[model samples]
Target: MHMVIYALVEASTKDEALAAGKTVFDRLVGTDAHSCAVFDYYVTFEEEDTSVAGKARWGDLPTAVPVDSDDGEELLDRGWEATKEEFERNLERVREALDEFSNEEIMRDEDLARHAFHQVGAYDGPMVFLYTEHASGIRHRGQLDRILEESENPWIVPADVHF
Candidate 1:
């Protein structure tokens, strides 16, 4: 499954978006940010924010961006920053985990584990205005509303268009 999200997170400063990304990533991957296998689905904006907006085929992903599974992103990101051998080991574990979770039911909207405002990109305030080939989770605005419920953030309540 694939997803697009608009989130208001506590990330007013640079790199703060990583925090928001971690929360969303954890929900989708079913892993925590501090785990040994976390992934970042977001793409960097070249000296800007990160957005988690894309489809992840099992084997098409790069070693830099690991696929879902709770803390895989955490592990992968750190390992990618660490020595080569450690990075390879972490990447191996993440691939194995993604294979295991691919066949399972997704964590669902109820799995919103972070405090932020989230919504599907098609939302046009009370209705879906547009949509794309992003996973078929668009017709469920009610579910999106629940997941994107208001969550106040002081530092930065960053927003995403389709991330």
Candidate 2:
């Protein structure tokens, strides 16, 4: 399977963003990272051909929507009720499993909770970082945040990667 990862780079122009993104990727994920070359897939929010590249500006990135809210339903909807139903069912299963585990046990196994509930990752803060499949990007979030702090105008770029 392939996933789209949103990478936030601090730069005032597209070329700058691309360069910064490449540097960040190279430093953190290495030059020969698995799946895809970061440079080959990086695209601005203004790009029309890539999925999740609809926003004309970084400021337009949408906030995370609660899974049970109407907006979440709309976001998950693809003109099929079955899709939404399946998503809800999966979410319910996760919730049930959580109920069965103690808070300390759940805390000790953070990956379990992140994997179960963060399937559809979204940016919900002042700055966006590289967001990939729930676990991958999150694993490096702290590093990305520190790296981006040195940037001027940070923006998210969507890149397609194979899994």
Query: Model 2 residue 62 lDDT?
Result: 28
| Candidate models: Cα lDDT each | 0.30, 0.41
Query: What lDDT score is found at residue 137 in candidate 2?
Result: 45
User: Which candidate leads in lDDT?
Assistant: 2
lDDT of 1 by residue, 79-98 (tens): 22332333344445545444
Off by over 4 Å in 1: 33-163
- TM-score for each model: 0.25, 0.36
Q: Could you list the CA RMSD of all candidates, in the order they appear?
A: 17.9, 11.5
Best TM-score goes to which candidate? 2
Count of steric clashes across candidates, in order: 16, 0
